[model samples]
Target: MTKVLLVEDDATIRVAVVRALGQRGHAVATAPDALTGLQLAVSERPEIVLLDLGLPDLDGREALRMLRAVSAVPVIVVTAAGAESDMVRALDAGADDYIVKPFGADQLDARIRAVLRRLGSETAAGPIVVGGLVVDARARQASVDGRRLELTPREFDLLHYLAQRPDQVVSKADLLTHVWQIPYARADKTVDVHLSWLRRKLGETALEPRYLHTVRRVGVRLSAPEALGTSPEQGTAA
Candidate 1:
């Protein structure tokens, strides 16, 4: 689930949005004023924040400025203000999205999702290279040495995420959360199945692995072949 911090002073709107977003699978946290919201933003480390333009303690824009100064968390302004200037100002001040009031849950949900997707794409930390494998996230392209690999969309996503942290063991649960955007309720078998296909395309297997290696009940790791201590023939079967 995505951690969402909602900063809205109005009790009715806050309750409605919190309830609706909770039903939609987002872990929602709320504050009725700017100061409390800012405090939560810094302490809780939410994935995204839904901010309001009008607040009791501090103006929403000022709060947004303070947030931008401290963190790069995606922010979507949800307010009654519909002025183009207000929208432009917020966007200029690093707001990922702007939404006017009197909107439905579906609309708000869509906006929130769009912002999070954009944020994910923007913060890839650049292309990842592991030995001969090259995954260019910005271009959504992967290659082995000079040969470009034609990967399925899921394969590419999985590879790109793994490549970002080369040599590090990433658990299936974390993969489900980051790659599948599934915070919970998904079997680890999904990751294994995809990894099997990915391994085949990379000319590897569970017994003799090159790039993607399974570490028993722990997780998987993407690393250079030489950096691994295990022999080429040594690895898990399941």
Candidate 2:
């Protein structure tokens, strides 16, 4: 059974969803406002969160941003806002999934299961090691050459994904779909920006990469220094 936190201000919707999810063998906690929800999220630490955008106390997007700051817990936006722009905004704000309101319990269940599956699949295989870089999936931590790399939740997720497939070229499209939980589209520089941040933290740059190598007009590859025709002792680029 999944532990779920439902953050919705509407009494009717909250009560109905609590009952519905309970019947599905889920243990659920309810919060009527963004502040209460944030507190419950930190203290209770549910497996997943079903958040509504129309909170009485705070805008759901702001709440989502705040929650992302403290936790990497999966969150699905369950709101009445069906606009594509709203969906994009929430996803960019770090929501794991998005479901328009007026949804049935079964649909919600499916989305929950799907998101869990996608995120859980990689971590289940345990830690991934490529050269001196170690990515501990279960621990949600990473280190390069025995030095821990301080990374944001999104950065860790991206690194973990690429580390799991070392030497395999991964397109930005795949990274968007998997890492960011969004589909690929032109003019999206999100992946590029995050990769730049990750590179800096890894003590490297795009022009002089050590672990993350860019394949022009193709994608990016995470491989050992030796695999990239560089000496393992070469160390991080300045």
Candidate 3:
């Protein structure tokens, strides 16, 4: 039985989920606010966390960052926000996946199982290194040289995907389909926005590209700074 921590403010929804998960043979715990949820996360050491953004105290996103800073626990955001932007924000804020409000208990069960399966598989990937960058897939951590880079979960996944195929241009559609497991939609600026944030953390920009390079209408490629013949002073629009 997996120990799942459910963090939600609404007593009705919280009680329903907790009872349902318990009936499903899960060792479940509950918290009504973000601070209590975060506290339980550290103390309980659950296999996964289900977090609600509409907390009475701390914001769910802020709590997510705080949780990520100290633990590699898988988090699946359970929120009322249904917009794609909100989903992206949650993923970028370190949520492993998200379940919008009013979801079925079965759907939540499936999502939780999927996350655990993926996390289980990741343990065998070992670590990937290119130049100064090192990606530990199992730990969900990345570092540049000896300095650790605080990457969002989605950012780390994106970078790890590109690092697996250095110098190969991966299109935005591929990113949407693969990295995010979502259909490619027009007017969706998720990939670009994430790339921009990722670029800033890497200490470079699109114009003065070093690691991540845009292929104009194609996609982006990740490589070593020296391999791309880029100086540390390069700058470009992300």
Candidate 4:
């Protein structure tokens, strides 16, 4: 059974979700406002959080930023706003995933399971070293050139997944399946957004990558700096 915190201002939606999750053998805790939810997030320590943006006391985005400041608990933004910009903004603010409102219980449960699976499966016997980047799966930490990278759980998962298979060009479809634990959708920009964030944390960009290299239509590959030639684009498929 998963422990879930549902933070929704709408009483009807909150009760319905709680009931649905309970029926699915999940233990859910509900809060009517963002503040209470934040308190429960830290105090109750649920494995996952389903947060709504239309809160009475605080905006969910602000709440997400605050929660990220104190904890790295996985958050899925459940909002009525289906706009792509809103989804990207929530993701940028540190959401692990985003689910539009009016979604079915089965879909929600699937997302929860995916997130938990990704989190639980990231353990390795020791740190994975690629060039100057060190990804310690056991400790769930990563560093570049002796400088630590403050990655979100999702970001770490993405990097670790690639580090485990260095130099192999992994298609976004495969990445969505193995790393995100979701079916591939051509329009989904989830991988791109996370990759951008990961690049930033690694002190590089797609244009001048040090560890991660884009293989054009193929996908992304992680390689030691020595593996590539003088140009970042060299040794990588164009």
Candidate 5:
């Protein structure tokens, strides 16, 4: 079941949303304010965050900024703020999706599912070939120079996702939901941990990476060293 962190000060709204999400087979954790939400986000590491803008202690936008500073978790701003400026500000602040107040539970659920599906489909389209490395999406496997790499299921999925979209940055939040099947509010360190393992297995390093390129404050891109103006022989999987 997907874990969700529901951050809302309103007791009624929190209870209703928690119940609705629970009925949908999700594990819901509620936080009464931005501080508590942030704490829960770090500790529980939910799959998604449903944040309300009007909080008693910290403003939602500030909380969002703080959260984004440490985590690449997918956050959906659920609030009464429907102004164009508000939406734009939230997006600029790193929100993945937004839902206005008075929205139906079904609509919220659909949006959540849509976000997850989009992430999942990002690498679902085709096989990727980068020099000696070949990633097959259909089989969810990877090989370099005709030698198969032993990967955990999560590693295979993560590598396949990156390879499928070579050169394009894939956000850590997207990777969490799409690959790990966990909520975005979880620690981005999880991605880092897995990526470190992936790099080691692939015989790569961050400073002189052979396959993975981390885009600062954005995400990661999988490409050949040639793509980075180095050499095609040093291409790496995403």
Candidate 6:
């Protein structure tokens, strides 16, 4: 059974969700607030997290930031806030998916399954090559021209995301939400900062492009010199 951490303060909602998920053959663990949820997340390492935006001890966003700092566990924000901005923010904050309140158990189950599927696909064995860089996703290790690139957890996540979809334009908004686990509106120069660090380590720059390229007003793309022969949108990151 898939293990899940359900972080919700509302007892009624929490019980309902837990029951529903349990009926679907999932092993559900409950936490009433952010602190307990964080502790459980680190200790239990659930396959996925169902996070409510409001908690008595901590704001959901703050808790999200803390969680992302330590884990890459898939998170789905279950919130009362249904505004487009709210959804965007939750995505930017690193939530794998966002489900507004009053959602049916079926919808929740589908979302949970989708997140699990995505995570499973990511962990599947494959040799990922972008430009001259080769990543063994199963090992979570990357090398450029046979020289291994030592990357921090976050940097590795960022690089892995880019490498997974080489030559595809990924907006900073998407990166901030999906990669950094920050809400999109909260996304800022942090993406740029990390990109700068990545570029420096890669021995390339936005000005003197090599592996990474900025698509004016669009986003960034990773590609190699040989891959540059195709359309700009089709370049692979080295």
TM-score each candidate: 0.54, 0.84, 0.84, 0.78, 0.54, 0.72
Candidate 4 clashes between residue pairs 3 or more apart in a chain or in different chains:
none
The lDDT for every candidate, in the order shown, is 0.80, 0.85, 0.84, 0.84, 0.78, 0.80
List the candidates ranked by TM-score, beginning with the highest: 2, 3, 4, 6, 5, 1
Please list all clashing residue pairs in model 1, or write none if there are none.
none
The whole-model C-alpha lDDT of candidate 2 against the native structure comes to 0.85
Between prediction 2 and prediction 6, the one with superior lDDT is 2
Runs of candidate 2 exceeding 4 Å displacement: 81-89, 230-238
Q: Model 1 segments beyond 4 Å from truth?
A: 125-238
Cα deviation at 234, candidate 5, in Å, is 30
Which tens-of-lDDT digit does each residue in 1-238 have in candidate 3?
A: 9999999999999889988888888988999998898899999999999999989888899999999988889999998899987877777788888888889988999999999998777657788888898889888888887888888778888888888888787888888766775556452588888899988888887767668887766678888887886434333344
User: Which is the leading candidate under TM-score?
Assistant: 2
Please give, for residues 1-238, the per-residue lDDT of candidate 4 as tens digits: 8999999999899889999999999999999999999999999999999999999999999999899888778888999998766865777676878899899999999989987776566653578889899998756689999999998766887898899999888888887766654444453678888888888888887668888888766788889988886644443322
Q: Which stretches of candidate 5 lie over 4 Å from their true place?
A: 123-238
Error of 2 at 33 (Å): 1.3
Give the C-alpha miss distance for residue 175 in model 5, angstroms.
Answer: 20
State the lDDT at 44 in candidate 6.
99
Clashes of 5: 7
Error of 6 at 125 (Å): 2.6
Pairs in clash, predicted candidate 2: none
